[model samples]
Target: MNSFFARRYVITGIFITLAFVLLARLFYIQIIDDRYMLFAKNNVVRTQIQYPARGVILDRNGKLLVDNQPVYDVMVTPKAVKPFDTVEFCKLLDIDKPTFDKYFDKAEKYSPSQRSIFQGQLDSTINAKLGERIAEFPGFELVLRSVRSYPDSIAGQFLGYIGQANDATIAKSNGYYHPGDYVGISGVEKSYETELRGQRGVQNILVDSRGREKGRFANGMYDTAAVAGERLKSSLDSRIQKLGEQLMRNKVGSIVAIEPSTGEILCFVSSPTYNPNLMVGREHGNNYMDLLRSPNNPLLVRPIQARYPPGSSFKPLSALIALQEGVITPQTTYNCPGYYVAGNRRVPCFHNERHGTVNLASAVAESCNGYFDMVFERLINRTGPKNTDTSFTSWRTNVAKFGLGAKLDLDLPGETGGLLPKASLYDKWYGRGGWRSSTVISLGIGQGELEATPLQLANIEATIANHGFFYKPHLIKAIGEKQVVKAEFTQKNYVGIEPQYFEPVIDGMQAVVDRGTAVGSRIPGIVMCGKTGTAQIRHQDNSVFVAFAPRDNPKIAIAVVVEGGGQGARWAAPIASFIVEKYLRDSITRRPSGIEPGYFMNASVLPQPAKPKPAPVKAKPDSTAKPAQAALTAGKHKKKKQPVVYAAAILKGDDDE
Candidate 1:
């Protein structure tokens, strides 16, 4: 009897221990870890993501620039797919059998049960056809989405575009983004993506065994509504922007204009510009490839990306520095007998003209290379040959105060901080002791390796227009409806030059438009102060100009560059004049003899493609064929760039302009 009681107790104890173990596991699964419960819920619940509509962009004048258009995306759940008539489904989707198979396979690979995008950005016609027959296809559904649309179709590169998110984007989002979502790729679209993309929400609905949607899960307790993105009011003036584009129709450079008081970008144009409409809807990929393959590089944002030597346009800054450093005064005179001779090296003046005696104002008005060269020598060699490096560093630092040799931290992406050489760089090239002011004299004339973008040049002019300070240049002026300006753009940036030092420089600039090299392109009544530059390129010179109007309390500051466009007054000066007139006077009155706006609009400076020669024909030449026509054809074929015509009488004795 004792042995039987012992066996029963031991069996009961073993059973009790087994019961506790099972209870603990059940408790853990129910309360501690909810993965199993989530798994169970996934079998019956369907979660659909609700994407918010992107914000609209407007000009400062309340004109629409970028708006949204409705589109549809076809989503599929591979596991829930019930094979139907493949031919009929393909016909409805406007796709072939092979394409259908490919999309299906891609979807299955991503997730068997989770929804994935099959085809996106379908137009209204496809959306209608597919929507009506969507019920017949068990797993496929249509989801509404929005894509960008440009009404005016300007600023293609500035507004940028959105594209499907890649793996890198997804990994960086930290669960915010999944596959098939879109992200801004560049420009203001990229710079303010977070404010433009908005918040995404989700909806939970009950589902049956075959994945058909039932009523809301738990009376919509788990659902959330999406919030639309904040609207952006950009500082772009549509009128100025449109006119700027028209003026630069056939050019291969950029024009950047800014409001000096506010630093707001009034208008910026990068030539060879394309219609922003090409970046939207079904043909985006093909159109992108076409633009990418263009030889003219219509996609390149030249305002902040293309860097070139500032040339004679850099003289004013050099003059200002010389005055501040006490190396020269406004009355300081330098004699230019065609060339500046330092040891055996001779730096020729503009056209090697003998401007016998010139003060600071006269030197700038005439763009006398020898005058600036001598000024640079004085500034750099101030402390003597033994301390040239120290003086050079001081000059470079002061120049940087004008926002040169560094990136401006522009609101757009892909800005290159233009090349500014340090003392170390010269040390690397010509040892420590070998280089001096005379050795790098080219820098004094704004040649050598120094470079600046058109945007930077525009900013330099704006700084001068404001006397000694400028605001950071920007596009967007307000966020949402609050009309709040960014704090960073409001702060004034001083170039460290005293306000009084800019007077003589302004006087010289006025003389340039009044009776100097740029006289041929001057405005009638406006007190426009300006300077011109002809930067040397490999084949031809790049025309450059910088200017501001009225001389006091200036409204607009501008910079223009025309690649292979000859003298600065030839192409760039007239363009700047036209832009200024449009902004201040609201009309362009004068079409000067050589700098006609109509001529620039119609002329083509782009290089023509090489064509195959026709079979040589030995026929009697017809007398009716004009020599002018024949010459034109030959010139087009033989030369890489077209030669510009000049009225020698009107622009007599003009040098760099």
Candidate 2:
């Protein structure tokens, strides 16, 4: 009996211990560990992301260049979807049956419980219509989003476009972006993406099983408000930008204009350009494909991407370097017999005039290849009998000070530093000691291996305008209202050459517009210092011109390049002059042949449709004709032949040297 009682006591102890352990676990789950409670709450609570409106981009004058337009996206949760009128839904969305099927399949593949975009970028009108009847649709919901809209469809490449972010972008966004988020693809939009894409907020709300919000989860206590992106005031002048585009409408080239004192970009134009609006909305993919296939490559940002020899335009920099090195002076003279002869190779000057004895200023005005060639040889061979690598390196360094052979680090992307051949390149081409100044005399005239982008060329002109110092070239003038530009842009960048060396070179450039090759392009009442370059290429010579206007206290500096456009004076020079006139004088005074000044002044981003041919003077119908009969006769008349849409003409030839 005693043994039985002990066993009963042991059994009772075990029961009590199990009971305590169960109670402890229950207490830990209900109070100590809140994870399970939160998990239960998550089933009833829904979190929604609030996307902020992107910033507005404006020209310097506060003209709206890019703004946000309210667009709606039809979102779907596949699991919540129920069978409904497929035909009616397709009709409302204005999509075909096949398109609806495609979107539905894509969303189902993405997720069954999570929301995904079904139809995105619907205009306000369609969105309003859809919202009125949205209650009938079970699984779909309307989500508000903003898409870019342009007031003026100019500066396509400069302004860029926004597109839906890909998986890679989302992965790198650190949880900031989702698959459907829009991001800038290129241009200023891409360069300033961080500043332009504002902070996103979130709202947690109580929801029923049907996914309809009941109310804020915690009376809005956990909700975060979205912040709008900062506004960007660009340095672009819309008027000048329009003019540049008009001038380059039918050509393949680029134009870059800047304010020399501030490094503010006035206008950036790439030829064969399309309207920025073409890349907006749902049709972007199709339009982008068309642009990609274009033979003229309208999408190329030529000002910073395309590189070419500067041709005669490089003479001013060469002269400045020569002066700084004490190899040449304003009075230093060189005799030219039409060409400079070095052993078996002869570099000929375009001008046949003997130019018996030419000084620095005269040589620049005449673009005397022979004179610059001689000066370059003297500068390189100055160190006794051997042309040391150090001399070439120093020469290249001076050239770099002008923003050559290195990227200018402009605010835009895809900039190239341009090609500045090194001594090692020569050593590889010819044995180290075998190559000398005579072997690369072509470089003195801005040919051979020397290459420069249009932006670099323009900055060189601006540097000259600033008298040996320049600010970094930039497109943005200010950020938000109170914020100024970055300190780096404001800081002065000085070339190695001294300020005094610019006077003679400036005088030479003045002569170029006053009476030289580019005399025809000079603006009236403006002291424009300019240089014309005909860069030799595989095709037609690329016409190039670089200039800064009002030689004293210059304001506007510009560079223009027309691929395969023969002489700089004939094409690029005139365009630069027009840009200067429009910027400073606010109107063009001189119009090139066959082009009216008003054509540029009143240019539109979209081509103006040709007016219908005047109706033929048909014999008047009988006065008794009925109104319906007359309308029928008018409609029956064959429509006038539609005017041919003009495309950018592709010119082919070799570059002039």
Candidate 3:
């Protein structure tokens, strides 16, 4: 009986030990760690994201240039969706059965862990359909997004375009952004991308087993609110932009207008420009590809990129340089017999007329190549080894003050450095600075390799207009959060030209409008001062005009270029004058009725030589011969671009809202 009791006690002890071990193991698994619970939670709970609204762009007058329009994107979680009607969903979305099947298969293949858009560019039609069918489709919801829209139909080139972020961009800015993000590719949008692209927020939601979205995770504790992008108020004026566009409709170059005192760009236009709104959203891909393939490439901002020789207009800068260096005085006279002869090359002045002996002012007004050549030659001497040690170095310093040979560092993008070959540059080419005026005489009249963009040319005129100082060229007047727009640009550059030199040049420029090649652009009742330039290019000529209004206390400074459009006075003058009149005096005074000026609209000024020619008769049924009466009777011409729609309807006024 004693042995049996001992064995029974030992068995009880063993049972107690096993029970304690089992309880300890249960506590370790259930209370000591949370790995399994996290895994379990993840399996049942669903998380989603909602994109925030992007900021808007407005003109200086508080008119909308770009705004966000509500759009929807259809996203699907393959695992979360259940009992989805296949046929009705496909028909209502207007997608084929295969497309629907493909998305479904892709989502399933990627699994519920993947976040991707299944359908994009949902219109109001699709939004309506999805609203009604919301009860039928589970786990598929419309993700609200915004598409960029342009309310105004002007200044498209200056505003630029936007597109999805690429691989390289993602790698660089990945900390702040993600895949499928939109970015400004050009213009002000590109230059101010950081201020324009707002911060993104995220949220993690808890869902029931049935995939119904429950209230926020931890009572809105785990959500990050989005920061909307800043509002940008540009320097562009809607009225000026529209008028400039209309004035440049038949041209093929660019026009840049700025307030002389502030360097604030009022109108920036590149001819053959396209609608910027066409370059956003689902339609962007196709439209962009087409524009890229187009011959004109209307997207390129030519005002800052298209470089051309300054022609006779550059003479004014050269004259000022010479005068400041004391190489020539305002009373200096030169004989002009239509051309300047440099041994073998002959640079011809306009009209082949003889001005006999002329002073500096009349020389500029007449655009005499001979007078400018003498001045440029003298300027080279001042910059070379002399008692004063006048060298190309000092000349370059003076030219730089005029805003040449470098980027303007404007708020706008795509600004190019107008080429100004220095003495060192020539020294590198001519073997150690021994080359003389004979080496680069044409530079006197702004010829040779010297090239400048229209914007730079305009800035030069602005400097001339201001006597010495010019406001830095800028496009954005204000930029910051939507609540408060900050002034982002405030600076000035002063050219070192003496005030005494400015008066003579101003007189010469005014003489140009009074009686010169640019006389046609002279605005009545306005003291207009301007310079006309006709640069020689391969196969044709490019017309250029630069001006600042109301000679004293000027307001608007303008630069105009017409490519393959011969004679500055013929093509560029009228456009510049119209812009000046519209800005200073309210509206244009001269309306050329029954007389349409020759513009870049034509492939050729005339299909044949500008001679009286006979008309052709209608072709009869002739099988063996292709004949125009066996004579060249081609005098007919056709315009390249036509006004298919009315101006008011096509270029609607700004901010309809």
Candidate 4:
């Protein structure tokens, strides 16, 4: 009897201990561990993401360039969905029943209990029309969002466009972005994405069965407010940008104009551009595909992407380099015998004109081929052929100081460094000991492997205009309402060349617009300085020009390229001149007779359907020609008789090569 009572007592003691441990665990789970509580809360609470408004982009003058318009995304938690009028819902959303079914199935497959986008990017009109009736459909909610809207349909390439986040972008966002979020694809939108895309928030709302919202969950204790993106104040001048687009209409090229003192891009125009608005809204994908498929390659950001041999426009920089190396001086003179002949190779000058005994300034003003060729030869061989690579590297290094052969780190996307041929490139082509200065003599006149984008060329002119120093070329002047200029852009970058060396080059550029090749493009009172170049291509040469205005305390520096536009003086020079006049004076007072509004605006250089050749007529010799025709005929060698306004088969195909 004693043994039985002892066994009973031991069993009772063990049971009490077990009960105490179980009670302790229950208390810990109910009070200390929030994970289970949160999991339970998820059933009664709906967490809605609050997407903030993307920042507005404005011109330097405070004109709105980019704005936002409210849109909605119809979200659904499929498990809570009940039988509703599918036909009525489909009709209200303007979607066919099959399409609605497809979307519903996709969302249901993605998640049954969690919400996912059913239909996205519905405009405010649809939001207003559908919001009132959304209560009829269980598990459906209209979540507010914003889409980019371009007020002025300009700067399509510069402003870039936005699209839904891809897998790569979402992964990069570190869980911040989901499948339905929008992200910048290119241009300023891309470069400033972090600043332009604001902080996303979340709100927990109490919901009953069927996923109908009752009110804020627990008095909105778990809610976080969304922060709007910081505003971007772009350096672009809208009026000038619009004018540049008009001037570049139907042409295949780019124009980049910058303020010399600040390095602010005034106008960035890439021709054959589409309306930025086309990159927004429901038609975005189709419109983007069309632009992508266009033969003109309108999507190309030509200012920073299109690399071309700068041709004669490179003479000024060459002159500066030669002067800096003490191989040439202001008084240095070289006679051009029509061609730069080094053994069997000959680089011909413009029209192969013989410029007799020209100084550094005159050589640049005349775009003298032999003069710069000899200068480059002396520059390369000054240290001797044994050190050819060293000298070439020195030259390359100097060019880089002026923002060549390297990215400018501009406030936009896809800026190519342009090609600055390294000694290794030549060393690979010809055995190290097998070549001398003569082997790469073509680089003297900015041909062969030397390539620069319109932006780099414009920046080179800006560097020269600033007298041997330049601020990094940029598109955004400030950020946010405080208008904070980036410290990187404010720092001055000085080219190794002394300021004194730039004087002769500047004088020659002044003469180029005043009495030299670009004389016809001279602005009357603006004291513009410029250089004209014809970069050789397979089918038709590309016309190129670079310029800066007012000579002293320069405000604007510009570069223009016109593919198949013939001579630089005829097309590119005048285009640059018109842009300068518009920027400085704010009015184009000196429109050339047939070139300004009619020719530049209407002319198309892209290939068109061939028309029957006009029947040849007997040649008549008459001295009389219109000012426009005379301008073409007055040059040393007459241009081929292509129509002034339009031509067929002009693009006969050459890529930027």
Candidate 5:
């Protein structure tokens, strides 16, 4: 009896302990951990995203370049959808039944209970028309969103465009963005995406069985308010930008103009550009495909992406390097016999004018090939260890001080550092000590593997304009009300050249506009310093020019490249002159006569006029026309007729080499 009692007591103790542990777990789950309870409640709760308004972009003078317009996205919850009139719904949404079915399947695949976009980016008129009857449909809801709208359609490449985020973008967004979120794709928009894309908010609400909102969940305790994006004040001058586009209408090149003192880009123009509006709306994919298929390659941002040999425009920088190295002085002279001869090789000058005993200033003014060649040879030979790698390394280092062969780290995307040949490359090619100044003399003329983008060339001119220092070039002058210019852009970047060395080069450049090769492009009242370059290409020469205006206190520095445009004086110089005149004088005094507004095949390669399109016929208004239809018709009529524009193509293609 005693043993049986002991065994029974042990069994009772085990049962009691198990019961107590179960009760404790229940208490803990009920009081301490409410996650399961919340999950159960979430079945009836709905969460909606509140997208904030993107910032407006304004030009320097507060002209609205880019703004936002209210757009609507049709959202659907597949589970809430009931058997309804499919044909009627398709007719109301202006979509075919197949599209409706396809979208429904897609939404169901995403999530049957959660809301997904059915059709996005509906315009105001369409959204209004659909909103009146949308309540009759059980599963569909209209969510308001903002899309980019351009007040003035200019600076398509520089301003960039926004589109829906790709899978990669969403994966990297750290839960900030979902599949359908929009993101900036290029240019200023891409650079300042974080500042321009405001913080998102969320709204939680209680919903009934049919997906109807009952009230804010928990009296809106978990709701977060959306914050609007910060405004951007760009450095671009809209008028100047427009003028540049007009001037480059028929060309295949780029123009980069910077304010010399501030390093603010006034205008960035890439030819063969499209309307920024084309990149907006639901049809962006198709329009982008068309642009991509075009032969002109309008998508390429030529200012910083396309590398061209600096050509004669490089002479001023070469002169500065020579002066800084003590290999040449303002009084140094060399003779030009219409050609530069080194051993068996000869480089010919296009000019017939004999520049005999030309000094540094005269050499620049006349663009004396022999003088620069001699200066380069002296620079290489005068180094401590003569005719050695040290000589070439010293020469390259001085050149790099001018911002050559290195990225300038501008805010824009896809900026090329350009090519700067190293001494090692030469040593590898011709073996060390076997090659000397004579073998690399072509570099003196800016022809042998010395390439630079228009932005770098413009910065070089800006450095010269500032008398040996420059601020890094930038696009955004201010962000929000703080005027947040980057410290890098504010600090002066010196070229390691003495300030005194620039005067002779500046004087020669001034003479270039006054009485030299670019004399025809000279402005009447403004004192301009300029250099003309004709970079050799396979089909034809690439015309290039770099200039700074009002020689005393320069306001603007500009670089222009015109592919296959013959001499720099012919196309690039005049284009730069026009840009300068417009900026300083606020009006263009001269327009090049050869250019006219018309359509043409390969406008950049060759000049030709195209027949204009016929005007639209005016239609008589009908009395039964709806208000929306009438408004749309009026809008069509009110579209300011754009002037005839030009299209470009690559001339018989040649390698950039």
Candidate 6:
């Protein structure tokens, strides 16, 4: 009996002590631990993403190039989503049940503390369906987003394209980006991505038991106000771009036109171009895949990326370098027997037909291979292992002045550093191996290893156009009043080829348009000085023409190349002429006869001329028109009339574009 009583007393003591401790803990929870209470309430609260608008892109003339449109995405948090109408839900969203489940599983991969979207950029029909059925499905929600669109799609390549950020992009962007964000991929858009992306905003909302938002947490102070991206004023001319694209149909090469004084690229075209619209929104992946696999390589930016032999286009630099070094004079003479015989071998000229006697100016006018061959050999022999070579260094210096084998700073994405040989490079290449001067003589006729980008070639023409100086080509005009987005010119390659040298070269080039090989491209009143080049590039022949018109005060400098072109004058020269005429004169009348409109190749520019001539009202199909047709017709410009505009120009995919 005594033992039983002792046990009862111990049990009561233990029970009373435990009850008191429980009471104390309850009081602590009610009064001391505010953290748990706050956390419990936060269980239902959420922060939402607020997407800031992307920047608009405009041309120098203030035309809109890129814009954004509203879009939506439907997503489900697996834990939050409840079951009902599984088949109907899948069908409504145009997805299979398995896909829905797959996305739900993917969403669970993220931490439970933060919310993330599953599907993105829902179509309008699905968005409408989601809106009507969203209230019925508890955890299902729609994320509001935006899609990029190009209204005109004119500068597809120049403006580039933007798409959702991938793993690589997210990794590189740091805090500035998330997986679903868009990024610029090429051209000006990629160059100014940060300025165009803008700052994103976030909103946190407080909700009750039924998932209705009650009010802001701490007066919404943690929220961010979305900031818009800055607009860019570009240096693109829409009309000029259109005309150039029209002329480049069925062509494989590039055309780069620059404003000589400003270096603003008027039109930079790579043939077989694609529509810019093909790269935006849901259709991008498909189009991108197709473009990549196509043998044509639509993605290649030929003007800046392709490095090809400058061919005869380089002879001008050689001639100028020789003149600058006093290796030759404008009055220098060379004897030709149709080929240059050095040592024991003869390097053949264009024909068995001999250009019997030639001077520096006449040599250039005639593109006499014999004259350049002698000059090259003389310069080489004067510079080397045998002779005192103060003039040899001058030879390389003068060529460098013409920007050979160097990259010119430009706004475009890819600019190739074209190849020009150096003594050291030759030493490293062939110096130790007994590579002799004979091995490099072909460079004299612009045929050896020297290469240049179309962009650099255009700049070279501008150099001649300006009589010595040239500016670096650029694309963007400005960002706003705060920034003048100009490209700076570097003098690293400036040859210091004096105006005295340029004067004679200009005369030879002028003769090219007036009476020589390029006579078919003659614009009657325009004193266009140009050089035509035919280079054997891989399996195809590349015809290139570089020119600057109104030779005295050049307004435009253009470089054009046509792959598989048989001769420099046939296709390349005419193309260069048309571009110049379109940009400067604003019309062309010289056809097959050099007397009539023939058939207007670029038909859309003018309607039809009243006198059965080229311009169209029934406007004259004047290729080079004044800024205004009336202004041109009112002036000294005349037109030949009445012709079929699209006779042979049955270009595909062009008319619709």
Could you tell me the lDDT of residue 30 within candidate 4? 92
lDDT of 4 by residue, 1-657 (tens): 999999999999999999999999988999898888988888788788889999999999999999999878899889888899999899888899999989999888877877888888886677788999998998888888898999999999999999888879988879887767888999899999999999998899897764567999979988999999999999999989999999888888999999999999999999878899998876788999999999879999999999988988888999998888898889988877777765344655666677878999988787888888898889889989899899989988887888889998888878788999898877785667556777677678887678999999999999999998899899998999899889999989999888888888999999887778777776777798888888764345788999998899999999999987766776788788888988888887743333454566776666343345434333213212222212222222233444543221111110111
Give the Cα error of residue 108 in candidate 3, in Å: 8.9
The reply for model 1, stretches above 4 Å from the true place, is 591-596, 607-653
Compared with the true structure, model 4 gives a TM-score of 0.91
Model 1 / residue 144 / CA error / Å: 0.6
lDDT of 1: 0.83
- Ranking by lDDT, best first? 1, 4, 2, 5, 3, 6
Q: Identify the candidate with maximal TM-score.
A: 1
Which model scores highest in lDDT? 1
lDDT of 5 by residue, 1-657 (tens): 999999999999999999999999999888999987878677778888999999899999999999998888899989888778888788878899889989899889878977878888876677778899998888889988898989889999999999878778888989777656788999888999999999999999898765678999999999999998889999999988987888788778889999999999998998877899999887888999999998668899988899998888989899999898888889988877766665344545553345778899988887887788788888877853346588888889888887889999999888889889898987786577656676666578777678999999999999999999989899998998787767777898888988999999999999887777777677778899998887764335677889999899999999999886666776687778888988999976633223322222224443223235334443232211223222221222122221222211111110111
lDDT tens digits, residue span 4-34, model 2? 9999999999999999999999999999999
Q: Which stretches of candidate 6 lie over 4 Å from their true place?
A: 1-45, 75-79, 84-86, 97-107, 110-113, 136-140, 209-211, 215-219, 385-398, 422-433, 481-483, 487-494, 591-657
Steric clash pairs (candidate 1): none
Give a tens-digit lDDT track for model 3, residues 80-182.
Answer: 6788678888887888999998877766675675555677667898888887887688767777777678887678888887776666787888555544456
lDDT of 6 by residue, 444-513 (tens): 7776567888888898898888877887778877875575554353332344877878998888888766
True lDDT of residue 581, candidate 3: 82
lDDT of each: 0.83, 0.81, 0.71, 0.82, 0.79, 0.69
> What TM-score number comes out for model 2?
0.88
How well does candidate 3 score on lDDT at residue 492? 60
**Number of the candidate with higher lDDT, 2 or 6:** 2
Deviation in Å, model 6, residue 135 alpha carbon = 4.0
Clashes of each: 0, 10, 2, 0, 0, 38
Query: What is candidate 2's local distance difference test score?
Result: 0.81
Ranking 2 against 5 by TM-score, winner: 2
Worst 10 residues of 4 by lDDT: 648-657
